[model samples]
Each structure stands twice: as C-alpha cells, then as structure tokens.
Target: MKTVLVTGANGFIGRNLVATLSRREDVEVMRIDSKNSLEELAEYALKADFIYHLAGVNRPENTEEFITGNLGYTQYLINILSSNQKKTPILLSSSIQAEQDNPYGSSKRAAEEAVFAYGHNVGVNTFVYRLPNVFGKWSKPNYNSVIATWCHNISREIPIQVNNPDAEVTLVYIDDVIETFIGSMDDPDASYISDYHDISRSFKVKLKDIEACLVSFKSSRHTLVISDLKNDFERFLYSTYLSYLPENDFGYDLEMKHDNRGWLAEFIKTEHSGQVFISRTKPGITRGNHWHHTKVEKFLVIEGEAVVKFRQIEGEETLEYPVNGLSLRVIDIPPGYTHSITNIGTTDVITLFWANELFNPEKPDTYYLEV
Candidate 1:
C-alpha cells in the first residue's frame, strides 16, 4: 500500500488534494500541519512513500515579510528531512511565481532554492511543480484569483474592477491538475532528462479575453484600463496531444455549479400555506432507519400497509406496529427512538408526513439500526 504525507493538509489546495488521495484505493493519505510539525513531520515521513511539501507563505502583505515566512519555514523543513536521512521522494508544490518576480513569485523561487540546494547534497529525489492559476470545484476565494472573484461578483451583482486588461496567465482545472500530478508517476520519456522540470501549464490566456466572456452579463458598459485582446483559438490546437494552452483549455462550466434561476422560479411559487413540506420513502425502502430528537413527526400512511419498529434508548423496550391507515393511523413518533421500517406491501407504498419543526438537515442528530 502506498502511503503519502501531505503537509498543509487543511489548506484550499491541500484539502482538495486530500480528498482526491482519499478516493484512491492504493494510497493512504496522512495529513500534517506545521503546528504539530516537531512531532508529526518525522513520523509522517517515516510512514509514507512520499512527502508533498505544500506548507509555505503563498500569501503575505509585503515582499520582505512573505520571503521571510516562506524561505525560513521551508529551510526548517528541509533541514529536518535532510538530517532524518529519510530518502522518501519529496514532491514540492511550488507556484508559477517561484520562477516569476512578484513578492509571491520571488518567495516561491527562494523556497524552491532551499529544496533544490538540499536535494543536490542529500541525494533526495526532489520534484517541484509550479501551479498556475488553478480553478474549479472547491476554489479558494481570495483577491488574487480574479477569474473566480469576478465570476462570483457578477453572479451576485456585486461591483468588480478589471485591470491589467491583457495580463496573460495560464489556468488549469482541479481535475487537470490531478491528472498532471498522477502523470508525474510515469517515467520521463527519453527525450527529456533535465533535473529541473518546467512543469508550468502550457495555457497562456489574455486576461482581456476572459473579461470579454462576461460581456453578456454586463448590465451596462463598464471599462477598466485594459488592452483590447483578440485571440485565434485555432492556433493552439495540437494533433497528437491535448494542448494545455489557454486557447485549447475551456473555461469553467457554469451549469456544473449552480441553477440559481430555476431555484428562484420555484422559490417564487412557494408560499406559507397549509404547511408545504417534502417526504419520500424509497421503493422497497423503510422509514425511521432512525428517529429524531426534536422533530414532532406525524407519519400518516397514505397507501399500502407498512411495518414500523422502534426502540427507546432509555429502556430495553422495543415496539413494533403495523400501520395501514388511509388517514388517521398517523403515528406521532417522539424523539430518542432507534428504529427502521421495511416495505412489506405488495405494491410500492407511500407515506405522507409533516413535522411541527423543520427537520434538522444535519444527520448526526438521528440514530440508526445495526442491520
């Protein structure tokens, strides 16, 4: 079994990575944070086949402050790993800025140097991946990610400013990033044996074109000091392989995330009259797989006969009842009952139930059966 240690595991990128790793059958993902680094880091490295170094100062107010936070902390990590003599393959999560010159980029480069320099002497197999503007499901909301910020603002009708009209940046979806990370597992082709892999995404999209996409949503003509950009989408197409270039990379699919207008239309039709609620029992399914604590539920069987069984946690008392009433056999089930119902009717049965209070959407409040 492959086990991997993921540092900064609670972060925006780390959380998503953790989820992806958890879904893998061959890998066990262990999470580590810097607060517990002294005790956890060494133990984690010893347990795992790989260490993904993602903990660093990706965000800070000033260049000097950011560099100090990033460089100093990574040096600590490198020293610890080097001294431990743990030859685990170290995969460092770097940003495009590491090779660029903004405060963030510079700090990333400095951090990369720490890893690279250490790798040279220790013979530790180190890999650094530079993430471009990554976006998709579970996107982190921060000022720098203009694509998400702008989309969210437009969705909410909030005002947003656009600048650097044509500042080109590359973007890859979370899924593609996952693919790239997994692809790294494959042996490098004979053509490339360079120690440093410039794994930067091939996509280069002009910022203005992304803005141009939002023209339909623009209520009125608003302008920010931006250069007008026109792109030839066909130029980036590659015959053999899918291009990671921006022109080839499609933007986010909106339908994947929300259905606001449809939900709102339904909302407008709903009114507080005769207490409208929702209830469903799956065909060949049961009710009260567990009962509630605060819900004042009235289960009125509307169709075929059904069996309802429950047990009180307070006593060794268990109760079974046959409910076949078209109307008033509606049983008022109080809370603190562990229960389950099995559909025994010849045909699919239906039960209409309503509560005095809204169902607590959280599932932890209910108890279940062992079976």
Candidate 2:
C-alpha cells in the first residue's frame, strides 16, 4: 500500500482529498492539522511515499502570520525531510494570488520556491498547483471564497452585497481540483502547464451572473422550475449552492391541487425535458378524459390497480392497459388520443406522470372527449 501524508486535514480541500484517499484500498493516509504537534508531522514524513502540502493561511489576523503559516511551516517540513534524507514526492496547493505583490501572495510564492528547491536539490518529484477560486461543499463562507459566502447568505435569505456587478472571477470546482491532485500521484509531469500544474477545467463568470443564478435557485422552490443544467458552470454552481442550504430547510412543501377525485402535485419542471407530477385517486375515480394536439405524457401506477384507456380522436376502437403497483409498468400516452385512468382497486391509487410540456392556461392544447 502507498502511504500518503496530508496536511490541513480539516480544511476544505484537505477534507475532500482525505475522504477520497480513505476510500481506496491500496492507499494508506496520514492526516495532520493545526491540532497535531510538529512531532507528528515529522514522524509521518519518514513513512510517507507522497505528501500533499495543503496547509496555508490566507486570512490571518496579522501580516506576519502569513509567513509563519505559509512559508515558515513549509520550510520547516522540507528541513525535516532533508534531515532524514527522504525524497518523498510532494504536491503543494498554492493560490493564483502568488503572482500578486500582497503579503499573502509573497508568502505563497516563497513556499513554492522552497518546494521547488527541495525537489531540485534532493531529486524528489514535486507538483505545484496555482489554483483559482475553489468552491464546493465544506468550504468556509466569508473566509477564502466569495462563492461560498454568496451561497450561504442566499440560501439563508440573508442579503448579500455586490460592489462590482461586472467584475469577473475564475473558479475551479472542488471535485476537479481533487481529481487533478490524485492524477498527480500517478504521473505529475503529465499535468504540467508552463511552470505549474493546474486543474483542467475552470469557469469565468461575472458577479451579476452569479447573483442571478443564486436567486433563481432560491426561487425554484416556489416555481418548481429547474434551470438548464447542461451548462457545466451552472451545474457546478447549483451543486455548490445546495451544499449551503440550512439543514432543516432541505425540504420544501409542494403545491397540491385538491378535488373530489384526488390530489395532484407537480414535482419538477424543466425547460427542455418538460415536467413531472404525482397524483392520487380514490377508488372508482377516473382522471384525464382529454386529448392533446401536440403534448405527450407517460403514466406509471405506483400504489394500486388501475386501467388506462386510450382512443384515437377519430377512431371508434379503444385500447386499454391494466397496470398495478406490483408489476411496475409505464404506459405512454400519445398525442391525438383521448385517454383516461380509472382506479379499480379498493384503496387509493398512486401514479407518477411525466409530460412533454408544462401546463399552460392560455393555450391548454387540451380537448375534452370520452375514451
């Protein structure tokens, strides 16, 4: 088994990386955080086949702490490895800020230099990732990532400030970063881009666009409408937004329409794929004596026995499909055919339905007819 050491095990990226590594049967992980003593790090360094140097400070109380946490600690770790004559391959998680002239950037740059020098002098393999704004689950809000802050505040109904709506930020999802980090263990040189290793995928979005997406996510509960997820950036951003929802608020009530026959509630609505809804009908009750001009639907009886009847708009022949919860079958309702479902069982019948388009009041496209 390969022995891997990870610093900052409690941090966002470290937590995700450690979880992934722990699931592998062929790897053993040694985790070190601020709570652990320096002696533990020294001990782990001796047995480590690889090290992920993710421990660093970006929001310190003082400017001097940046050096102590980012640069000084990195140098100390290298010194310990050098003393033992160990040549363990190391991967450092540097930030894009390293190119700037701020104190945090200077400290990160110094740490990168230290790792490169160790690799050069000791002939050990090294990988440095100058990551952009990383966002996903477990990331701290208002600390390092603006995405995290927006997700947290928007999910909780707290007001968020947008100083510059046109300002753009580049982002890399946590999963992508983790995948790139794991890939480095097998072949570090393959991911080299110019001077450092980087995640293959990144998204550049304007502040206004991000705010709009988050607002839409919040409004989805009321509208039952899901935004287009085929776009990679929106998909990733939506996942990140959900990760910040309050624990108790994970579920929301759906609007149900009640009538003498039964109750029906829409579940999900999408722009391209259409909508899905569930319904319940009392025994001896029949629903849907109508035909659509262009819309189509699918019905699956999930809880009781039912018979779905369909008839062509101009034909006298009627087709019947008997379905039950135990059998688990789906019946497609074609356009230009009048259809109806009758619950024959003693108990209420539960069915799931999918439609090709959202129900429109102005242009229902539905004509009442007997089936």
The most accurate candidate by lDDT is: 2
Residue 214 of model 1, lDDT score: 47
Q: lDDT of each structure? A: 0.59, 0.93
Instruction: Report the lDDT tens digits of candidate 2 across residue range 98-213.
Output: 99999999999999999988988888788999999999999999887899999999999999999999999999999999998998897735433225887989999999999999
**Local error of candidate 2 at residue 332 (angstroms):** 1.1
lDDT of 1 by residue, 1-371 (tens): 78888887876567778888889898888898757755677677677777777777765676687777677767776777778776666667788777766887878888878777777776656777787776654454445576666555554456767668878877765556665655554334412211455443456778776655544333212221111222322121111012211343333321211132111001011111212232334446665566667655566666667777777766577788777645448676778776665557665556665555433346446666532
Clashing pairs in 1: 97-105, 98-109, 203-246
Task: Give the runs in model 2 whose Cα sits over 4 Å from its true position.
Answer: 188-194
Which 10-residue span in candidate 2 carries the lowest summed lDDT? Answer: 186-195
Least well predicted 10-residue stretch by lDDT in candidate 1: 261-270
What lDDT score goes with residue 50 in model 1?
Answer: 72
